[model samples]
Target: RLIQRAKRFWPAFVVAGLANALFGLLDAGFVMLLEPLVSKGLVGRDPETLARAPVFVIVIVALRGVAAFVSGYTMAWIGQKVVAEFRCQVFSKLLRLPAEFFDRESSGNLLAKITYNADKIARTSSSALTILLRESAFLISGLIYMLYTNWRLTLFFFISFPAIAAVVRVATRRFKKASHNMQDAMGTMTALGSESLQGYQTIRIFGAEAQAEENFKKTVERFRRKFMSMIATQNLSTPLIQLLAATGLALVLYVSLSELQSGRLTEGEFIAMVSLMMASLRPLKQLSSVNSQLSEGLVAAQSLFDILDEPEERDSGTVDLPTLSGEVVMENVTYCYGENSPALIDVSFSVKPGQLVAIVGPSGAGKSTLLNLLMRFYHPTKGRILLDGHDLESLTLSCIRRNMSLVSQTVTLFNDTIRNNVCFGLKEVPSDEKIIEVLKQAHAWHFVKELPGQLDAMVGEGGSNLSGGQRQRLAIARALLHNTPILLLDEATSALDTESERHIQAALDALMTDRTTFVVAHRLSTIQHADMILVLEGGRLVEQGTHQSLLAKGGVYSRLYRLQFGEPQLGTTTS
Candidate 1:
């Protein structure tokens, strides 16, 4: 996959590889020049050759510098582009993944993939590639030069090469294992840090600072140990390889010196051979370290590829409804989450084009799950939902959601101006007058006007700067502005005070005059006037009737209503 992504940047990598090879070739030329300069200038006392030698060295150095610049710059550019593309692909995939995927994964791990793993891939593509290409080229070139000078000594030097290769082979496996561990540890640390930061207030309020600190320290310690293990393997391989190379160099020197004394090899040739042999050592050492870098990058790439390969939310529907009449029907629907037990079972209901339907249930009664199915965040495991007489599965997900607006208890507001949050994703940006009108209708205009910047005032992350009621009102205002034919209110007024709830409810009443509305609330008072009431318990619709009729029946709804609002029986009589 990495290679597939890199195809577009192949030209840059090819240019970099050629330039790096030129750098290696220049090293061989420098080594060859060193012999004549030393012999002719120092021993034979040739002044003209010595003077020209400096100019020759200067030209080689200048060309090598140019080659180095091109290699470095081009590789870095390719690395950055690769990192950017990987990040974009990962983020886009995250957005398209099924809701179940998020339910089973952590946001922090996803974030680490984007920030940490992507960077590791960049380093591998850039610096690692540079070293692998340049050093391997330099090593091969140096070997050729040494062979030209004297093949016998070059053969002796290569005797230790197999030992170095064995060391690298053994360490490569350890490096990959340690690198994978370290990446997982990094994700754990990021998750811990994210939780601590987001819940700082909870930590302080509960006086669990010590516990939070200990947990974080433990996470960091694990990460540190894994990181050290990776470093240990990488560092150990280099010196061991270098030691073997040094032993080979010593053996080669022992043989070469005897050849020199016997007059079989010229002093210039012997010196040149030694220079080229030594030149190979630096590249050899770099190549040893490059293995670990490449391993780390491969591990990161594998982690990211796993996410990218996950199947996206199934969207096979080809029908697009430009508008919906707001009528909704569910026919014997059943749904489950993963291998867990069913969430909704054989449930059935219907809503007229503009009727208000209230779904009241206790916690864990599938209220939110039902809303999720309606929004097509998840498909029903069995049966089907129909919108305006068309099967929801046959309609495009966007088309299904386009006619609906949702206001839940937990309102999502980005850290941006109130105007932008209210008008978010509107086909045409609404006029200031239109924005204020919706705010007024939702009873949010009063507080918004009191702010220093009015509609332009910035809301902190998740609208933290706003009070609960204020945030709820802003959410209601947003839904109002959407002006869709369907409205989903999941405890929308749960955050508001009685007075605020009354005002917002009035606004909602006017807004629902021509739109289908679904209200999921545990607060019975708010939905008492709903056009139809569906009572649920343990994933079953236990009761369905008007508020007054259910109260008269004295069934599950009556008992629940009595529990919340009916008069308490006297205990004194029994005493």
Candidate 2:
């Protein structure tokens, strides 16, 4: 991981190293100028080229300054490129991930991994790589100059280096652990915010605003504490390194002064060595700081790699059904949401082309689960679902869903113009007239045309700006515009009032004319004319027939019908 990350900025690292080395060499050369300035030149005794010595040093310094400027900008550009590539890769991975992966992971937390964590990895990796390369190069060049000037004094400085390494190692391990905790807390905070925002209406309706705020505050506080702790752990390394540097400098200065006094070291040589020692400040500081930054980067890289490494969606051996007749069949399917609680068991049914089928049952009777399986949102645990004459598992998901349209209970609208929402499922740009035609057919045109901007008004997020019935009607209009052969309606009319339901049901009746339709309906009256009315109880198909045929038999469907529309004391089922 480290090597690959470094390679991402290889060009920058290489350029920074060369530039830093040139600066270090010039630093040593400038110190050599100090010798002449103090001795022969400082006395103002020469009238020759010695008068121009300071000008030569100034030119060298300017060149070194320009090199440093180029190095910094080059590294910054590399960092931005690396982050951009990482974000794009994560987005591509999201498209390839299986649908079940989204069910198990929160969208907000996954978004953080793609955006937040990728940036952290890029910033830390690039900064650390830049620091490591430039400083290591400067430190090496500075040390070579020091040794050539006086190897004995340089050797004295190395004695305290082991202590520096030991302190940095301990600090970095804590930093990495704390950083991981901080990132986990961030994901939790994001999840809380996302869930709350999505369900803001429910929170307000229940008057649990305070409770939701308190819950969000708790997550924010936990994340704050974790982040502060990580920052403290990283900060500890700086002071520890400073202590090591102070101790090392004291020893080196004492030994060098004694050498100078004994005539073993020239005055010019002693000053040069001291200058080189001062140059160690940035490199030595960076040597300690790099470990902590690199640890944080590794923590982020581990998170990013964890996401990228997940198993992607497979299209193996899957072929298109050419064209579907919209005959759906579920054969003895068993499905469980968890290991212990079954959602559906041994459920079987079939719907022929252009038939209208209504699946009615009590809540939690696998009504939605059956639709979910047909949509391939979750694969069944046992048996198979067939589209046309081919098994659903044998066809590509895109191929199967292309022939189907779904208008669900919970309507979703993008913050876009009404025309786009109505034609969302089309692979190509749809004609404006076609969208308006469907809107008229769905009985949505009356309100839409009255709006200030017909078909062009922006629907707020999830259509929150529209009334419930209006949103439902728009959803129906969208389905009608798609014009697929199959339609799945899951409580699509539950939000509508009696008058609105009557108006929209007529439109739905027209839309379902020659389409194979499956309706998960709670109001039995709406589905009385279905070609097949299946009564589901406890995940089993209890009764199956047209409404009139089931009423004649006087079974579960008859009991439910009487319970819904009959007098309480009539005992209609027993009669």
Candidate 3:
């Protein structure tokens, strides 16, 4: 895939490479010409020619330098363009992926691919590609010049080229191995940083700050060691190539001198031959070095492709129902987070419009699981869920989500102004009056208006600037802004204090006026007014009825109510 993607920039790359080759050929011609001019003017005592050699060499060097510069700059520009396009494509794919993909992967790992792995390709494209073009062109031009000078000597030097290639091949393997370790270590460090920041409150509450820091430091140190090791391996390729070049240069001079002394070659031709041989070997050695870096670059490219090739959301594209009535039916739904470990079992329920139903369960019961199913984060192992009598799978996932609003136990907000967080999903810019009304309905407007910047006040990362109750209010406000007919509240008030819960409950009471709501409640008192209360245990619905009827029956619901809210009154049958 990377190769196919890279082909998009091939035209520019080829042009830049050819420019570099032409420059190398010009440089070699000028250098070879010098040998003759030097021999004719100095050895043969031609003073006029000797004076002109310096001037001619200067002009050739300047022109060739300009060509090399243009070639390098153009290649870098092409590389940047290709990398930009590649990154944009990757980001687009990420956004288009289904919610289930996020459940199975870490945000930190994917983030490393985007920020670090993509940067690696960019660096490789700019510098490694420039080296590849310049060295390849120099090597080719140098080889042609050497063969033209003396085929016999060129063959002798060429014999060692394979040996240098072997050394480079071995060294590059080590560099690639080290590069993998380095990238993995860097990912580990990134994960640790992300975890620490995301769980800062947990670490602080548990007084594990020191341990967290130490863990983070360990990952950083491992990354440092791995990258330094890769650098060491990459650097060794250069000196190793130079050693081979020096050995070959020594052999060539010895053989050429012997040939000249035997009258098999003229002094001027031998001088030119020696100059051409140096030019060829020099570039070949540089190319050997570049070969190692480029090989490591391919390793990074492979890592990038590993992410880009991930399976995306599999939509059949058969139907795209945009709106849904507030009616949901769950028929014999069975689900498990892992194989053989049930989370929901043969669960069946129905919610009609304007009905407030609460799902009450123990800690391990499948209250949240039911909500996840309705949202299509995970499909059921058996049975189906229908929205307004239409199968959820038959409709586009985005279309289903647009008509529903979910307020989970944990509130998620970005580091943005208060108004933006409240009006998150509105494609068109929402009027300030609408945002203010929603905030007021969610009981968030009073405190928000009290703040210095009011609606424009910046919420810190994940709304860190707000209190827990304030954050929950903001999240409720977000749901109100969405104004979907179907509302899923999964322990939305479970984490709040009593006062905050009361405040939020009042807000929720107002918001639930006409919506079909599914409430996952842990606190029994919260669901006393619910039209229907279903009790779950071991992934199965044990008892379901109105709070008063369940109390009369004296079943599991009554048992839970007594345990949580203390014993209930007699004759309080179905409200």
Badly placed stretches (over 4 Å) of model 1 are 569-575
Candidate 2: tens digits of C-alpha lDDT, residues 30-129:
7666655654555555655476886887898898798677766776777777777777877898888877788789888887787777778776756776
Better of 1 and 3 by TM-score: 1
Candidate 3 per-residue lDDT, tens place, 249-346, comes to 77878788777888776777777776766666567656765665676567767876765787777654355666666888889999976566888999
- The better candidate by TM-score, 1 or 2, is 1
Lowest lDDT block of 10, candidate 2: 566-575
Clashes of each: 0, 0, 0
Q: Give Cα-based local distance difference scores for all models.
A: 0.90, 0.81, 0.80
The C-alpha stretches of model 2 lying farther than 4 A from their native spots are 1-65, 204-207, 569-575
The TM-score that candidate 2 achieves is 0.90
Name the 10 consecutive residues with the lowest summed lDDT in model 3: 566-575
lDDT of 3 at 284: 62
Give candidate 3 regions above 4 Å deviation: 26-30, 204-207, 264-285, 338-340, 494-500, 566-575
